[model samples]
Target: MRHVIALDVGGTAMKAALTGLDGTPLYEERRGTGRERGPEAVVESVLRFAEDLSVLGRERLGTAAEAVGLAVPGIVDAGRGVAVHAVNLGWREVPLRELLGRRLGGVPVALGHDVRAGGLAEGRLGAGRGTGRFLYVSLGTGIAGAIGIDGAVEAGSHGRAGEIGHVVVRPGGPACGCGGRGCLETLASADAVGRAWSAASGDPDADAADCAGAVESGDPVALRVWQEAVDALADGLVAAVTVLDPRVVILGGGLAEAGDTLLAPLRAAVAERLTFQRLPALVPAALGDAAGCLGAGLLARDLLAALAVRT
Candidate 1:
């Protein structure tokens, strides 16, 4: 069976799969990223994991992988196949595609931003399926987004296109890791809500899930925190909708797990903020955590298609 290696490298874990050309997974595995051992160790771990998967594919299916696709967190230069920077992983200008290609005996490799890759899967096979235009946002430890057009996610000219998290929604509110104040993620991300709830509940270990549970139980303090986050998120999203005009907005990641508790109020908030722009259908992501790996498989398949066209 001819297959491709698809990997989604997160800050703390990596999800990998050996996938058939039709996007079915033949084998799947997950491993810790080992960032605590340093970036070099993390890269080595990824290479070893891919090599093991390749070997496993050959042993089980009687063929080697034809290509590889990797989705990683950080500032990615997809056109250049480089990972420019990832604060969490401490990577800088790493030629990930070239490195993987070399390690895998020169097989073609595609590298992409994790959020963009997830959005690609979501747009093509998940919530945004059949939609011509949409935005995919992940509200995790930090917020990030991907803009989808037609069947593909746009990486923008500089591969920084869907950075909605850094958009200034509150001007002078809170400091952001991106060196800005009042960025959307600072107020709306899961980490932000956890912090706020921790303070409000006077429990240092409180997190966003706890906050959501509290809100579900009708706790006034949790409601306040949740609403604040929702308001900030709505502000940032309106800014995006004003510019992108996507027909659908797909919300994913940890915070999105709140389900209707998040969406009901969020839909109302976004609707209230809109004036003349078309209201988009706000929906939950369908793929869950599998999106990035599935998207990496799609990337590998697309690379093979492009190569076939060239030949």
Candidate 2:
């Protein structure tokens, strides 16, 4: 059976799968990215990984991949087939699609931002399925978002449309990696919450999970930290809703793993802030960590179909 190679490349690891055009998985694998070795090494690792998957596909299915889809974290210029930048992976202006295509023996390849691709999968196949308009927010080490319209995720004019994390929630507040002060990510990201809780609890190693546990135990300091993060997140979401008017908001990532501990207060806070804006349904992501892999498969299948139509 014909299949495609789907790769979701992260800062620390790569998750890959071989899937049929209909999105049925035939094989899956995981490997460390070796990012500690530097960006060039990481790029070589990705190329090598793609080659390995291609050989495995041919050996198992009697044919190589028809196409390949790659999801990478960074400022991606999908139109140019380049990963503009990713701080964690130290990638900058990497022509990932072209490089992967060459490595895969010229199989057509599609490249996309990881978060946006995950949102695409969620909107079409997971939590946001059938929702006319959706916003998929990932609150992990850093925060990012994908704007889903109909069955697709919109990349926007500059491919930076759903960057809700940089929305300034507090003027002159915490510094953010984006060179902005008081950005939503500075306050609401899992890393940010962990930092705050660590300082308050004097644990030094306290993370968002620990903060959630403390809140469950009715720890006053931990509850304060969690609520602050929730409030900041709600502030950002309100601004997003005021502009995008999405029908649903799907929250995912490490912080979201707290479940209702995070959602209930966020919902209430967002509700209190809204005046004329329509309230969007808040839900957790359905695919967990597998969303990116599934999304890469979807990207490859869609790209192949489009190419066939054009030819």
lDDT of each: 0.95, 0.94
Error of model 2, residue 278, in angstroms:
1.1
Error of 2 at 61 (Å): 0.5
**Backbone clashes per model, in order?**
0, 0
| Deviation in Å, model 2, residue 133 alpha carbon | 0.6
The residue pairs in collision within model 1 are none
Pairs clashing in candidate 2? Answer: none
Query: Given candidate 1, what's the lDDT at residue 80?
Result: 96
lDDT per residue as tens, model 2, 85-189: 999999889999999998877999999999999999999999999998999999998999999999988999888889999999999999898999999999999
Estimated TM-score per prediction? Answer: 0.99, 0.99
